[model samples]
Target: MGLFEKLFPRRPPDADPRAYFKTLTAYQPVYTTYRGGLYEMALTRAAIAAFARHCSKLHLEIVGDFRPELAPVLGQQPNPWMDASKFIARLATIYQVQNNAFIVPVEDAAGRLVGYYPVLPQQTSIREYGGAPYLQYEFWGGQRAAVELSRAGLLTQHQYEDDFFGADNRPMLPTLQVMRTQDEGIVNGIKNATTIRFLARLAANLKQKDIDAERKRFAKDNLEGNNTGVMMFDSKYADVKQIESTALVVNPKQQELIRESVFEYFGTNEKILTNTYTEDEWNAYYEGSIEPFAIQLSLVLTAMTFTPAEIAQGAGIIATANRLQYASNNTKLNIVTQLFDRGFLTHNMGLEIFNMPPVEDGDKYYIRKEYAEVSKLNTETDPTGTTEPKEGDNGDHTGDP
Candidate 1:
């Protein structure tokens, strides 16, 4: 061994727990009852659920000549524990909340791909060693595990940023604070409304004992929702007046604005929460929000699951959202008819549009007779536009001359 090597032995890169321990602090407030429970709030819950549902409905396909043999593992069932829909939904929720999702591939005894598992971003941390990233996973039971990025089998889908870790919704903290305050105000208003207050007028010289007796009688007779009459002494001069209760008034526009802020931050819209989006609006939402997610996921899956040689040979995965899901049957028919009439789409392409099998000779393109090219404008005329024929031409061009 060299003198330098003998003096200081080289060690494999190890994850530093302290590096990510601070991020856990940021998550602490999110687990609290008031703030963290925002997910359970109507607006927040609805937005997250809608976004997650949109993502869950996407269809993943292996689009290449040399398709990977792990289609079932990646598409149908990520593992025996969860199907594709459930897995995708969970990942979507994680993505909505944390702005990042991590998929760890499970391997069989022979190191062949078997299943997939999702790791919570809050429980995972990334650290760099020797200029390469390593992952440190802290399990629920306080178990800590480390894996190098090269062998981590982890695929990450996240909003693009320079951090490489991922972007989060921390930017929404101020808006969330306002939402929490509003919720607390509403709850407090409701609670205070239940308590009935009464203003009582008494004689100037009434005795303390008499005043106490009158107050007790008022409480007993004026029980909530009970209007029984109470008799009082004439000398007491007691008069009871019930305090008016006003219903809490929440501004509809302000509430909508707050909800919209939350939805917009998550790349969704208010229509998803209300389930009132038109077909076109739904398509726009998919394109704006879900399509980017699918693309990022496809790229991540290809990078993590396929070998460099396989990718070079055009073997990779693609995640595609079913656009037809948001389109009506009539709309699909109209679109297909228009495309077919314009000769912009082939028969097989039309079939693929509706997800049907292609037929023989379906690849041909056609144009209307009137729209066909006019070579000479008339079959009887030559290129010079002359109808006369030379010496060897008969009347029928049969060489009988």
Candidate 2:
């Protein structure tokens, strides 16, 4: 055997991660956001790749990470872009944002951040203002600034699915909905008790990182910001489902920076654009480019809440452990991809919404909402109108489209 096979004897020779990941027929797609400058699309791709590298090194497994060997066994992967697009297209058909620009999905490889095809203003008189720049320079600058808001960590990563299964149900098996049998003849009259228990353990093992400590650790190690942090948390009792919390740098100077960033985003005069451009002109120029960037910025802020030191200092952060559980390589890349798909996030206008929970016994408990809001984007508009083309799918578009 060759030296390559000595350490990892079972790894496939043609182990392209993308190919491998394509095998997960039932895998879900999680969306994440990226903004800032003109190269937001490229930056988002790079960040995701970097995250994947980190997870691979640490050996953590994100659901989207490709594994062809596992594909034949798992079934199929879900096409997220198509699903998101269908949703957005429906919304666009139902509701329009008046003059404001909106985006569906655009990939970096295509040289677009969101699928931004600018719509020009409706000009009534052709001769009076024939050559007026429908979108003034300031409008472009504002749109650019909106992308920058993503740098402020104002975007969110949301994981949703259009359907529960793949377009084709292969490897068919009967669906079994099971529950505990009340008053069965025998408590131990099971033929496969051990196997069922093992499966349950495997499920827990896959999602071990969802625990408060593990999620917080992942956030602190990967996310970066001067005064913000994120942590995973649940209430003290069973009544509370798990949620993420954040922290912020509440000092006056930091607050000022945030406000200025907001001003740049909403335009200096508190409108979508400055006075140099007329309403019709501004609307058309930006009708398709601004909304997604806005969405991305809001989500970034949500991720930036976790502190590196706080997460790294926890007991569960084992340096040498399962790569799937660690925040490196595959894990980071998966997060980056999901974040890119989720779209932009809104800035909370500098509200110190929540605080971080106290650490106990060398373990952090929760996330805070200091100077931030973790609300979803306004859904009154077409939620599905904002999707880009499917890059990795084998052409399986389901649902609305």
Candidate 3:
């Protein structure tokens, strides 16, 4: 009914899931637990989200003229179902959380690579079939598919021991447990501070029923909204003391340790997660987290999308971003204004630095007229326009030329 719906309609329920993973072998019903379940935690989710958001902003450009037919699909929109932002965001999130993510080619009716998509299955494994390596995917609904391992791209981290997959988050469990303990301590502390308001010693002469009635009466009279901050009590109690309530103060050092654990593991810092990072911190975070991901994604996609011959001909994929996006406005201004006048940046490149679209013939390079080759400068004449006075003439340059 809406314009957006008309443009990007939802997939039909009856459509086959093969739109994602193109299988070359029989499906498997295997169901294995994935270790990425830790992404559901708060800090883990925050780290992944921050990483994915920045990664999604990167531009996936297909370099060279090798795969002209598939360039449009792979560059802006990996698949018809999702745009570049959604596709890259989902891929980055999966790669960061799972430590291993896969991208398989989506073929057309003629078996041509039309688009590529990340297939996130509940279980995935590499199997050998007919002397060839095959990658298998098992979905949560018990659906499964298999593809040639060479045709699929894999991005992995913590991949020291396993030949095909990355290691699990076993070492990080202790740090996570410390975080859990701190949270529980805070919760229990708050319960203690807020639950019991007063401690009273009742007179021993009162009967059990009288004591119960006195307790209820005291609560009804003093705890009700009608009563002011002043808590009033009768002579039924021998002694009474108001409990002091204070906030649960977690140890700053312990909290810092927990934060450092997360930051180190994710290769990020508090400023990056909070979006208050300086230019230096942003560059560090980009190189540590985002640049590596872009590099890996570029290499994997290039290898998966092209043959050895094509790659040898300089046909490949590259993921690049305007690292200046995180720089301060003044820095960006300097980059655009300074670089533009020197012909260091083309018209489109200058516009792109500010995230603007190119105009007609925007690829042309322009430079200021004052800039010229050093060889072209006249060495004989004084550049100041006053001719040097001859030895015989008085030191006035206007006398002779």
lDDT of 3 by residue, 1-401 (tens): 53223321332233223332323434432224466446867887899899999998988888888778776786678887888888899999888877888787776656677777876777876665555556666677775566777888888888765566776677778887787788889999999899888788886687889878987778787787544778776676788898899869789998998899888999988888899989989998889889999999999989988899999999999999889877878898999898888888888887777778998998877888665446533322357765454456565445544
Query: Which digits, one per residue and each the tens of the lDDT, describe model 1 over residues 90-127?
Result: 88777766665667666655556566666663466565
- The C-alpha TM-scores of every prediction are 0.73, 0.13, 0.80
Q: Which is the leading candidate under TM-score?
A: 3
lDDT of 3: 0.76
lDDT of 2: 0.26
Between 2 and 3, whose lDDT is larger? 3
Candidate 3 worst ten-residue window by lDDT: 3-12
lDDT of 2 by residue, 296-392 (tens): 3223212222234433443111111222222344544554354333432112210101112333342322332232222322122234655333446
Alpha carbon lDDT of residue 373, candidate 2? 27
What's the lDDT for residue 169 in model 2? 16
